[model samples]
Target chain A: MQQEQSIAFKTGMLSICLFILLGLLYLPPESVAQQESSVPPGTAIPDSIQLKPPIHIEVKDTPDDAGGSVTIRWEEQPVLENAVIQKYRILRASVENSVPGEFIFVGEATNRATVFSDGSTDDDSTYVYKVEAVYELKVDDTTVVTTTVQSSVSDEVSSSAQWFNFQRINVFVGVVLLSFFILYYIYQAQSGKKLFIRKIAGLEAVDEAVGRATEMGKKIFYIPGTQDMDNVQTIAGVTILGRVAEIAAQYDTWLEVPVSRSLVLVTAKEIVKEAYSKVGRPDAFREDQVHYLTDDQFGYAAGIDGMVVRERPATIFYMGAFYAESLILAETGNSIGAIQISGTAMPSQLPFFVAACDYTLIGEELFAASAYLSREPKLLGSLKGQDVGKALILISLLVGTILETFHIWQFSSLFKVIGE
Target chain B: MRREIPLLITAITGIVFVLQYFIPHAPFNKMNTWFSDWFSIVGAFAIWLGALNLLKISFQKIMDKKSDWFFALVIIISFFVITIIGFAEGQGFREPGTTFSWLYDYVYSPLSATMFAILAFFVASASYRAFRARNFEATLLLLSAFFVMLGRVPVGDIITGFLPQQYQLSQVASWIMTFPQTAGQRAIMIGIALGLVSTSLRIILGIERSHLGGGD
Candidate 1:
């Protein structure tokens, strides 16, 4: 009887121990949280207790600039009131051939920050980005627990250098249309089609001015402006110089060209030499005639003024781009009783030239000088093409105005030079 | 060969530059920057060439004892002195404490400013000559100038104070600028643009070769 009683006691104890183990295994999650709270507050929380990952992460390439940047944006997922986010950690991975490589820690932003620009990317590369929300819990200002939850990786984005910008497509189209018209007219001109160009008083006076200078036995002064050869105005002035030089060579009149830029001086020397050669008076061509003055705007003006006062040329040509010194030069020329012909594309300086000079080639008339003087078929054709372009622009403006007046705005937007 | 080579180079470069405006690709952009750098280098060389030419001309004039040779001598001396100082001191020549800087600040700046200041007097003279109502166009220009000048000053407002706000001189001036002046300016600009396009096309196609000394 004693042996049987002992066996029963051992069995009962074993069963009780099994019941306790089973109870602990199936304990409610609230009791587990309570048990955890009963411990020291500084204890580390398990991974399951971490904050949720941020939601709706977006990655896109930056636009309208040299390609090298990607923008990453995200918002935090919903969390309990007590959840404290410390910061967000950003990671970047290079994507190659639709496969993502290992991610490297790129940068970090504060907890409240939701945007980051990854500017360290190479041009024409693909990339993926990941954002991690870092949460931190502090106990008694001494111990702290930190955890991180990573957002879903953004879709692959390939950054590429655009070969053509569609935003400026309107400008491109305009250029193409104008070029087509110019080329078509050029072909027609090459086939010996006659075209008419209006008379430019400033250009027509070229012969008169050279003739007067020859008759008066006084030199002719030509100032090809203050800008360098890169300027279109200077190029136009040089073209005019060729014709004037030819006239001077034919008339045996001394022609002086005082230039502000060295390149212009060289170019003027070449043009005059060629002109004299063409006129069979190369012996009259003087290298010293076309000289370089100071590149300073006012210095050139002062030099020209001195020349006007002392040498007292019979005629002066102020052509190409001018700034504040336009009136200064033109007035000084006027004061010397010299007939002045001026041309420039600069609108502000045009009035000054017009006010002081005998004849002023206003705006496009300056560009038209070569075509008018040379009367080359190709040049004449280009001039006619320019008229066509002007007519087109005027028509478009009228149509656009009428359409906009009727509240039909979409038609005008087609001509917008910028935006998507 | 000379003409052909130059024309070919010009055509290629012109087309490339036009394409560069539209292209944002790597090779084209790189080429554009390379060309720009080359242009800057060429510009520096051109400056040197200009300085050398000036020195040669001035020296010749001094030797020949030409008219105003003394001024040429002064220019040469000034040029050499500034160049030497700039070279010796590097960028310090532009600093305030340097002799070069002092010359530029006190001498050059004042001389340039004086020349610029003389423009005011010249403007008055030119305006007097231009506003002489010798013709109908001159009379119209004079009237426009008068209205613009009057409207720019505060006295114009006081003179037109009795008139309606829109009829005031300032308002009238604004209307003239906003409509007539703007219209004229736009017409000029459009014409200039068309001219530029045509001229550029002629140049690229080698039709306008006067700039290269003669026509093709």
Candidate 2:
């Protein structure tokens, strides 16, 4: 009975000790902070603890661009020159009723950076921004201390869509002026005013090539290039094709067009049919004459080469946009002893055509071919309008060069293309 | 009626597109994108029309036992096989290991590369004919081509090693390309741009109607 009483006394003591330990664990954290502040004298306080935030934080919508972006800029604090700043953190908050909501970390820039472009915002939405300068203080080999002090919150700025970019005003003016000149000349021509157009040898040879094919009793092959109707060069090529088809209908010669684009094929068919009907030979018009070949570049070239070898056409007309296949098609036509006439606005392919074909239209001449061949007053007047435009460009270039030579840059700057 | 309707449509659309360049307002920009989408959709339909036309011609040639009818048969069979493989395999038809991809990699790719390779021979022949020095202009062209060819290779450096680096063949070639060639190219581009603008104006004003098949 005496030993059991001694054991009960020891258990009571142990329960009291356990209660004391749990009480220490649940104590308020402020006491610990108070104790740390009560450090003994002569201890050094780190300089990073006194670091200041960046100054003059500003945010606004970026100018001269398609919207949906805001630019944030700030000035570095003087303390940054002495302190070892690691980086600056940019924080963004959505604005509601003139108040910033919960701040979200947007991005980080290096210590040297003073600008940041925030491209994540929605259009027509207001946003507030802040920049925090971060400083690191290494206490030991294993522990590095970091302190981030944020600047004054930026003013609310909203990204909004812009109508008619002011940056492209130069281009707009140029187009307006050119269109005015062209329209004026066209009106004059319509009113029966005669306009002179220079003769293009390549265009003049079109009739000769068609006649040669007719005399030889051989077919004429017309390729309107490999590109679709979207290309201006291809459209020009089809315009030339219309004239060629008319000649073929009149001469009663076989005309074939193998196109690489579906739209071109349909357009070519309509054009050929119309040409025959215009010549009063609708009976001779065949829908099967103009057809679509493969859209593949080399495949189209191979197909044309095979046709040239097998059918041995007397004349071949290549008028359109071409790339590497230009040389291949031209050389094959030359080999087959055909009178090849090629026209393209592709500067790179011009050399190949000139080298291999009997007649070649150099750049602008290809675009001018239809007007020259048709001799329509409206088309002739347009050519005169183009000459005036050229004269204006030449004068501008000469003036710009002279101004630049004399260190006068304002005139040249007027021609600068913006928002590209 | 046919001519008038088409001309009206052309004028309206052309004016809209031209104005689209200057106006970046919401509805104007939206309309520009919508028109472009319509063109793409119409182009898709045109592809079907073209395919049907091709089939009609090939089938007729096969029936008539025309010369090279075997090629027509080959085209028909290949088109069906490829189309079937593409449809059956879905989007993965173009993936590596599929039949469509295998045909493209082994057959179409090689044929394309072969045709491109033939350009080297053709260039050689064309250059020979062009560089024949038949006349004064031809001789000038030949000289320029020779200088360009020589400057583009290591042999040029070795041949002109006696000159200073600034006056080296490659340096001269660079100068030619940068100055004279660029100037000439810019002039042509300017001319082409003017011509394009004038031609487009004529079309938009309904003054040029040859493309509508010689209509008044």
Candidate 3:
């Protein structure tokens, strides 16, 4: 009876396995038939059904926030071309880096033909790109598709440079005024000119925040944003870190900097070391205090959020190029009841910082904050120069607006001349 | 001497660059393009400086063996690996079956999308916390934000009862964006522009050397 039962069970399991195998085999044939009926790759179409090549393949010029991507654009062929053209296949070949004539297919578009972009190429790379028009063909029993590849590649393009557009007429006026002020200030500095800038309420609060942290024996948290050292805001943030470190050193308080960017970590370390040296507390400046987190945006945020919660700091300073993480960090700091002062030039993230933090630096104020904290003549002169430039712009806008309002067409030309 | 040389270069290049914009002749335009190209070359060099700085810190962390040093090691390893796979091999993962290309398209793209998706949850939370009717201004903001958000989604038209042909929700949203959002954004933008102009002037004139550090 046991042997009979085992035989029956074995037979049932074998049938079940066979059914699944047959089902898998049956499913692929339907998909294969469907694929076979559709147009296949490299199938040549009739010459009568020709499609126009891509038009005006223009590469975009923009700032490279992250060093890897470049955007390429092209105008769509006419609607007639679109009907015949099944899809647009963008083929990219590296002219400089790869073996002489190797081309790679980076992107494709079946529906949207007008614009296709390729980030497959690196910024450091010089690439030659050619787009082709793929045409669909209906044969007796099968369909064929063909691509009329462009004869020559598009002009070699490179990433845009880091040069600021300093050539605007408004900026010209600004430069002149700023130059005058800078020269005057240099003379003033030589002649012992007394330069006075009002004390920043935020900076003034720094000492108290440090003292409170020292009293409670809690750490002071400093985040120098996620941006690398190239960004000016990060530099400004690190400068403020120097000041905060000095106070921490003097008060015998622990100051910790968790930087998102690796370069920022190095710079913040040096700045902290210098501050500790100046305060004669070099021994207290631990290399471990300033450390690097991951370069990944959210990964760094998660690390910082963990640190903020686990080690509840008395004061939290967020300054630099922050994005979505600003709110995450700021809200977490607020919940901890830590005094949070945040500053960033990123316009989109500014509102979050303002809503969540005790004090927020709006655009230029973040730049000026470093100068205000440092009180050096050179830095102060720059702040004054910035003001003069603002004055020039204000005057230009006022004059331009009034002229355009009064329908003085000839004066408009003068304004345009100045504008250029 | 230190001050004079920088000042002279700043004034000459600054004035010429600005003046060239007004004069649109071949020579001036070419000069502008040339200036931009030179700037790119310098920018490329700056990338090396940044990358070096990045490696220095991460390597130091690995050597020190601090807590969470594994993250630092991962960063350094990934950095060099990607750089090699991308530039050295030149068959970036998008190039068919290369390891780097596969990692980039499947791993990097999805990871990027995931990071961006975090904004949805954050927006929901932030809106919930901030969109309260505490005051008149807050109420107005809440109403506009609600309308904008609602109109963007498919359910917006459903809620508004088959939105009339003339008073389309999309048009209203566009109008709100154009008039109020544009006006406010432009005003902030103008201030930012002026700020940038001033900052550049300061940099060129050597007034804003804080970016370089406080001293000569």
Candidate 4:
């Protein structure tokens, strides 16, 4: 009887262990099976796509206008003896502190050429580029839908193009005007010449918004945008944040800032602290008021939605780079009837902001906003210089178009030579 | 001196950028290229500065025993791990025939997809919240949003009975995205571009100085 009982007990334990082992092992496979069942065939990443070794790249002067643009060219992979090359993908990455892995898809073209023109007129910057060739494969002999297989990605092609050498006449004209302003401004600045800038209505309401929050004893919600610090718009957002924090400190209003990017979060903390210190309310600065949310876009948006719904801040300020989530956030804040002031350079999100927010800064206006609110002479002077530059561009455009219409090909050629 | 330096740099870079647009010659052409290279270098340095700043603040938060210290700790740990894996692994996931590459392929790639998959729920919830007909404009907005959403999913075809026939719901969706939607987007883009130009001009000319914290 004892021997029989022991055998049964041993068998039960063995079955339990087997169940646990199978449970753990079965989970991942089950999950994967569920995913496969739901996902349509051919939607997932194929087995063939890859990054080849980095390759030597060459940069040459671009044709047309002043040489602000560079044409980068690299050798294509020798076509396999049997396989047909279908397309080339050009990827670009900036050189500084940038993870080389963050290659941006710049251009894609059929196997006709291996050269690409980098005509980004912003300024001189060094960028590393990579190229990959996709090869054609006949998945089935019966149908025309040939599944294209990407070979091991071609080597990353690197090239450096400098825009310092290209100075054109239109640029010269713009330079002359700018030089005149700078010289004029330097003398004026030395003499302490006072300049007047127009008042920014959006900024004017900031103090009132904070005061209202203070009166109601409600927290203030501030979003410094969803972009990393590498973006210029984020820089502007942080600077404006300095002013907001100062008002919050003076009014003793609860100020909460949730940031999507770690870098931007850090900047906001510094700016907010500085503002608090400047307001002589350093003790009131709470570090937790500015916190880093997840870097995931929708995750951050989800967090913001929760915060807005739960806390119900009386005033919300959104400043910086925004994308699709802008509408979701603005609409939520609107539902809460929060007074919203938003500033961003994202053209796509501006309409949503305009529709939802009480005040919206459009495009470059966001960049100029802090200055507009400050009315400082130097800032005002720079804005004037920018205006002069634009006017010069506009005048040049008019003259060039008129000359082209009149068959004065030489004048037309002047502007036609960019990004060749 | 504080304001003068920025003004000079802005004026110089701004003018050169304009000139290069019209004159395509040797020295001037080359100068533009050099300028672009310099800008790239500056941009690179700026990125480094930002990264350093991020490390400094997170480290500070951890040191101070702040209320959200745990979150800060997670951030620092994740940042360092990612950085080390990225640099130490060299080309990281892009490196073929490596463990890191497989990790990226199976782990990071799927994680990204899963995160995007989560968006499906949030989008549905957000649509539910936004679709109420509060006013005429709101009604119009709800209508457009519904069509846009339906036009994207396979269920739209099932409801409309269009895809099996030549009038594929996907093609109709593409047309909606490309034409009327595109027109609206483009109009907004044009306004934004003009606004940007004018605003940049105002800043360069120093007519807008509120950002410097003295306009008050």
Best by TM-score: 2
Native interface contacts kept by each candidate, as a fraction: 0.67, 0.66, 0.12, 0.14
- Residue-level lDDT of model 2, residues B22-115, one tens digit each, is 6666566677889989989988889987788888888988999989789889889988998998999998889899999999999989999999
Tens digit of per-residue lDDT, candidate 3, span A13-113: 99999998787666633233334434455554556555566777776533322234456667766655323666766767777776555566677877465
Model 3: per-residue Cα lDDT over B1-216, one tens digit each: 755675677667766766565554445547777877875676556555456655676788688896756866877887888887778666444577787778778877786677567667665666676788899988988888877877777676666666675455656676787799887766666656555554555556566543332233
Any idea what lDDT model 1 has? 0.85
Local error of candidate 4 at residue B168 (angstroms): 12
Model 4 lDDT tens row, B1-216: 755665666657656655555544556556777976775676555555545544666788689987656765765786677667777877545677776677678866786566556545545655565577988977977877767778799887788784465465656677777888887666545444544444444445554333333222
DockQ metric for all predictions: 0.58, 0.63, 0.09, 0.09
- Measured with C-alpha atoms, the lDDT of residue A387 in candidate 2 is 83
lDDT by residue for model 1 over A156-190, one digit each (tens)? 77555667877778889999999998889888998
Question: Model 1 - which docking category?
Answer: medium
TM accuracy, model 3:
0.58
- Candidate ranking under DockQ, highest first, comes to 2, 1, 4, 3
Query: Candidate 1 chain A: worst 10 consecutive residues by lDDT?
Result: A30-39
Candidate 1 lDDT, B1-216, residue by residue in tens: 968887888889888888877776667767788987887788778987677877888898899999889988998999988889889888667988998898899989999999999999999998998999999999998998888889989988899999989988898888889999999999999888888878888788888877887545
Error of 1 at B55 (Å): 2.2
In candidate 1, chain A reaches a TM of 0.73
TM-score each candidate.
Answer: 0.81, 0.86, 0.58, 0.53
Candidate 1: segments with Cα more than 4 A from true spot:
A1-66, A69-120, A128-154, B88-91
Worst 10 residues of 2 chain B by lDDT: B20-29
Residue pairs clashing, model 2 = none
Runs in model 3 lying further than 4 Å from the true structure:
A1-170, A181-204, A260-266, A331-337, A376-378, A406-420, B1-94, B102-112, B133-137, B151-172, B200-216
Worst 10 residues of 4 chain A by lDDT: A143-152
